[model samples]
Target: MSRKTALLLLPGLAFLLVGFLAPAVAMLLAPPGESAGTVVSRFTEMLTDPYELRIIGRTVLLALIVTVVCVALGLPIAYLLARSTSRWGGVLLAIAIFPLLLSNVVRTFGWLVVLGANGAIGRALTASGLTDDPPQLLYTPLAIVLGLTQLFLPLAVISCYSAVAQIDPGLDDAARGLGAGRARTFWTVVFPLALPGVVVAATLVFAGSVTAYTTPYLLGGSSQRMLATQLFSYASVSVDWSAAAATALIMTILVFLVSGLSSLAARKAATS
Candidate 1:
């Protein structure tokens, strides 16, 4: 509120404006030499085209699935990690988060190997007589979901872990002493307290999955094109700048929209 405080904030505000806001605004309004109306028309066409609609739907559906899976797995793991009494608790957490240190390409390639026709999964299935032939796994939506889930799970865990860690362990014990069972205590006491973190984790995972390029492109291939791959095609292959910019704008809006809803949900949960 003070002049000195305002001055201190000015540099960070200026940096954000220059680095993020300006580019985002420009990309939304104008794509290189294309006018606003051109990009708007492309965006409208993308919404109406059945093929493009499928791409958008697939992107959202997969993102939602990945987000749900990550939260379902991550929350429990994070809670356990936060409450671990073992001396190796830190080691366990390190193992859980280790995947984040690896490149996305490396992790995705690993999936390709495991999910390929002659890959580990297919081989195992065939050897067990589960199928007469290797079921096609790669270049499918399932493969994209699996790869994106693996890629973003650690982020979910880390986000939830910090939140779970902040809650006093005494609260859990007190709830138990008051005759609440483990599940009840978690739902009533721990979860409500941790909803914000869960929302944050979901938002991050959804955003990453939606905008992710390598895993979707490599695993899904041409058959399973999501918005990111579509954007790449417009930008590079077709050289359609307006369409590319429109796709980028849509992805950005999807992320921001989810984030806004998540924030509102978190606040409502807090108030409730």
Candidate 2:
């Protein structure tokens, strides 16, 4: 590279190191005034302890469920939107991602209202004679999953839309000409081409769901704690810096692992 190009990149690289990398490394290593051994021991405990294992398991399972649900729903919507020739296509695309403009807290609270004992769902159930009383739905895994799915669905849709839109519509016609059905064309052509985008969407949604604090805390409550809430308890409530650092490290590792796997899958799909 030219000296000018190297110099131009220097400032951005310096900023990235100082701004993000250094602090992230420090946090994963050990919290302030804590020994590396302390953090390591706590991390080991979290892995071995049944309580902590359950929280971690719950976090992972919920995240997987959310990712699958979002991808299953988002991919089809994105495909339809991308293939639409209607003038309303632009408007429909905008509407698909509109939830992103709303704050996460706001959307989560909307779920709170709907899932609450006296909320819409409960009221409807009672009015329909499906139940004699309002069922407790707020502080369950289901609530957390629903809230997270709503929170991340728009992101998945938009990511897949961008991916699908980049592919040539002519490819679909070409597949049809070769006597391939719509399902076969999509599986053999469109889906493979769009796999990278789907991977990106899934990675983002999984990471967000696993680390998300607001939705899980509010929806799952004290009864159904996830890793993020556990970390919060360690950091703020219990004042256990070592454990908090360990939790953060675990979350970071989980995200990185999923990202790596997703990248590998996308590359394989692209090549195949």
Question: Candidate 2 overall Cα lDDT vs. reference?
Answer: 0.95
Task: Go through the candidates in order and give the clash count of each.
Answer: 0, 0
* lDDT, model 1: 0.95
lDDT of each: 0.95, 0.95
- Per-residue lDDT tens digits for candidate 1, residues 1-272, read 99999999999999999999999889777978999999989888988999989999999999999999999999999999999999999999999999999999999999999999999999999999999899999999999999999999999999999999999999999999999999999999999999999999999999999999999999999999999999999999999999998899889889999999999999998798
User: Candidate 2: misplaced stretches above 4 Å?
Assistant: none
Clashing pairs in 2: none
Q: Write down the TM-score for model 1.
A: 0.96
RMSD of 2: 1.2
In angstroms, give how far residue 251 of model 2 lies from its true place: 0.4
Span of ten consecutive residues with least summed lDDT in model 2:
24-33
Q: After superposing candidate 1 on the true structure, give the runs of residues whose Cα lies further than 4 Å from its correct spot.
A: none
Once model 2 is optimally superposed onto the true structure by TM-score, how far is the C-alpha of residue 176 displaced, in angstroms? 2.3
